[model samples]
Target chain A: MTRKHLSTWGAVIFIAAIPIVIAANSPLLQWRDPVYIAGGFAGIIAMALLLFQPLLAAGRLPGLSLAVARRVHRWLGAALILSVFAHIGGLWITSPPDVVDALLFRSPTPFAIWGVIAMWALIATAILALARKRFRQNLRYWRAAHSALAIVIVSTTAAHAVMIEGAMGTMSKAALSGALCVALLVALNDLRVWKRTRPGRGITTD
Target chain B: MTKLHMNRRTLIASSGAVLATGVAGGLAPARAQSLAPTQSMRGGSNNYRPGAPIVERIGGGGFWMTGTVRRAGDGAPLSGQRIQIWAHTTEGHERDWHSHGATLTDANGVFRLEMPQIVPAFGQPHGHLAYDSEEFETVFLRPVMSSARDTTLEAHFVLQPA
Candidate 1:
């Protein structure tokens, strides 16, 4: 309904779509191709949007009209989910075993563990956000935890891209790095916003 | 005919399926011995001539894995351990190759491979081998040393927690 609500659903949809699409193919998929590239881009955008959602929700960015940011954030979250699905689906179709390893957190490679943990964290953060109203829990605690997880998501996703020996090359790495930087900046802005609201201990009530 | 003859006598009987097709010498053997396709008489009593030195060894597994591959006699790390591992289906018929396919050991004569439980069916050969969903298997280890060095190689196995 509202932009925040839409974004929330969008993020959930993305996370949920992964196993569905990967299982879509029987044999699985490969990574060295365009689908994966596009999916990577989409993932970056989706992460960017999810990170921005909080700032818009709290009315942090002034010039970038709060309403517009909220809308973009929602759409981006949906797009992010789509990207994740595409990334995993493409991989599954080409190399299902790799996807299986990634999903099960049994990948022998270094980045795989970080990626899996980040994925689970993203899902958890989304759920917490969605149920915030009903739960009546402390918003600050949720916000802090969400922020910490967001950092993990960005770093781990970047590491995933960086460590991939095939399919992803220089361009993908550059793009991933740039997007990560943007997410970091946006996160910093959100922190500043929260700080301004608190004006004392850097804890925002609203 | 001669190549085939050489393969039957020297390669299959002695090398154990190495050199898929070719061999070092074109010299035809005088006689061919009856050969059986079974895991018997490894190295044909030549007494384990080690393989080439391993340049690198990169091992990884499911968040945790540990093992040692060494030259059989001295118990020292076989610097050039050429270990190949594969997991097989419970029936031991099909190869879950895509998931638990062949893996090589690293320079320290050690390797750990983190494998996915499910495998994608590709053009993988039938009846190969793979890791089982319920259990793990240590497949193969061929230590590489020079012809001059008399060597023995053994690999230890470790499986994930059930």
Candidate 2:
């Protein structure tokens, strides 16, 4: 691989690993139970996957074809779903009532509300992805709607993740959250999901 | 048995009342109007023990783990509420059971426990505190000190109705 290629991969790895490493080094982890730690790490991994998701979708990642990227993105999306489920499941094991209240929108904690919103949006995004062949009938509308939902997922998830004062180091968490937003914006811009889905423009060929 | 607790009661009884915001004697806050229910931060409860013992002091005293306990919204002082205190200290890390203990709020809604001086861990000077009473929603506070050299760390909790 070329120097540029190596550096590109390096930056990606750095963004993905730094937050998890800092959180692992947190002094607070000593008192945590095993399940909580597992759940927490899963959430962190999901965030890291989010950083990868948009890049893959926009074909910005260095080494993959659009076909390969699309496959990897789908698998990563599935992994994202599983990671989120594990995240919630772990917390549920730790504190059932809090999770239930969050799911029901009755939790008083601000983070829970944001988390629930992000989660449902993610499920919706997954549904859209699964029905992509059918969505081809109105590809502009589908892409635009998918992009909008992706924005909601990314923004609310970032809010949910950043608001928590758990194991993640604050500065690193903020940096990761910032990176997630930037990645989504770049992907959305490159993909041009909003390019022709308007009042004046007709549906055009890709 | 309790210097922090007894001193507070004595000061309140003798003075009848004191200044609102000043750290006069053991009063935590007369400014409860500003207190809001604290959100339990994610991952803040890492090393929490469900029933840390109510101790007069941890590690034979010197450092202070102090704060106010009040009801959310109204901010009424929560008398007798159990507030568990723990931290990485001069003696050991917060993960050590020896570094953990609990204390109760006085009639004024203030609670303080003596412990060994807190030491910075992972480059931050922080102490972990929790209010896990059945009567009130749980709150986990991880208050970081401005400097590691400081001797006292405070973490107030404004709990919502359960």
Candidate 3:
């Protein structure tokens, strides 16, 4: 096979291996609490999705076209929302008081607070994405709003995952979270989402 | 294409920096306590009973909390010991909350308690379990934090002889 084909397959294998390795190393198997396990898996899925979000946005996946990457990005965003719901919902079922504490911003655990912030930011971003058509008249504002929310989601989720001591092994989890943070930041920077656009440089005025 | 390559290079370099910083920062011991503060479940009710080991799975739709009861010193199985569990759920913790139940250990001193759909009660994700038997000192395991991922929790209880 060609080098490009090898690279594509290598990327695919690496991505697939990450979660499998994480799950294998997780104490979840030893603990065996169904609700807790579900919640943990949801958190892991959300983290895994974070890795894809920026890559998809930047059209970085080796074998995928830009159009496909954008489409995948949208779908992944939705999946991320669902994963967060599952994560929080499972936790809620296991302990409503803790969930309430986190939601109320009174949880003593910094991880819970960060997770709550990321969850809300993710929800907000989803809502904004869904309402993209309605914001057609002000595309720049919409883009800015979306990008800001994205940043919040990436940063807060990274913080949330890093702070938790459960499920994912520390080294692997940190690596994943750090890679996600950097990837999103780099993608945003490269796309110039964080910078002001030049007056005549593809600035859409509706 | 050249622009894409440069972007990839930048992404790699930045990711490396982030990995180094994150590993350093993330590995630091968490300042916050790992376990949530224990809460009391005593005021609710005492459903303790001693009979032919109530072995039925109590409630449906929640995770299973299973474990073995053993002597603290010799590690021998403490069979026929009554194990009781109770926790708050999405449903309010009114009197006669059905989440509360009891069961006896099998011949091997193993027991399984099916938790109901749980809800946080007092700023913690916890449940209460106790080993109440005539021969053994009453051991109350309160505010046992729920696991995050495992479908069934294996929580062993070691009791002191009364």
Candidate No. with top DockQ: 2
lDDT to native, each model: 0.42, 0.78, 0.66
lDDT of candidate 2 over B1-162, digit per residue (tens)? 111223565567535544533445666645444334677655457567788899888987788888888776566888999999887666765667898899999999999899987765432467788888899888887777877668888877778888
Docking quality tier of model 2 = incorrect
Model 1 Cα displacement at A201 (Å)? Answer: 15
lDDT of 3: 0.66
Considering the two chains of model 1, state its CAPRI-style docking category.
Answer: incorrect
User: Judged by DockQ relative to the true structure, which candidate is superior, 1 or 3?
Assistant: 1
Model 3 docking grade:
incorrect
TM-score of 1: 0.44
User: Which portions of model 1 show Cα errors greater than 4 Å?
Assistant: A1-63, A135-137, A168-172, A175-179, A193-206, B1-162
**Interface RMSD against the true structure, candidate 3:** 9.9
Candidate ranking (lDDT, best to worst): 2, 3, 1
TM-score of every prediction relative to native: 0.44, 0.62, 0.55
lDDT of 1 by residue, B1-162 (tens): 011124456565456533432365444552434332222111111111123222222122221122444332233443333333332111121222332233444676575544322121211111121122232222322222122112222235322222
Residue by residue across A1-206, what tens digits does model 2's lDDT show? 78887898789879889999998887656656677678888888898889998888887788777778878989999999999999999877765655777898876467778988989999998999888888667877788878898899899989988877677888888988998999899888787676764433212333
Candidate that would win on TM-score? 2
Those runs of model 2 whose alpha carbons end farther than 4 Å from true positions after fitting are: A197-206, B1-162
- Encode model 3's per-residue lDDT on A132-164: one tens digit a residue: 899877776788898888889888888887767
Cα displacement (angstroms), candidate 2, residue A91, comes to 1.4
| Tens-digit lDDT track of model 1 for A18-116 | 323433331323312445445444444444344454455444444455557656655655565566666567556544554576688755455656666
Report lDDT (Cα) of residue A52, candidate 1: 50
Native-interface RMSD of candidate 1: 13.5
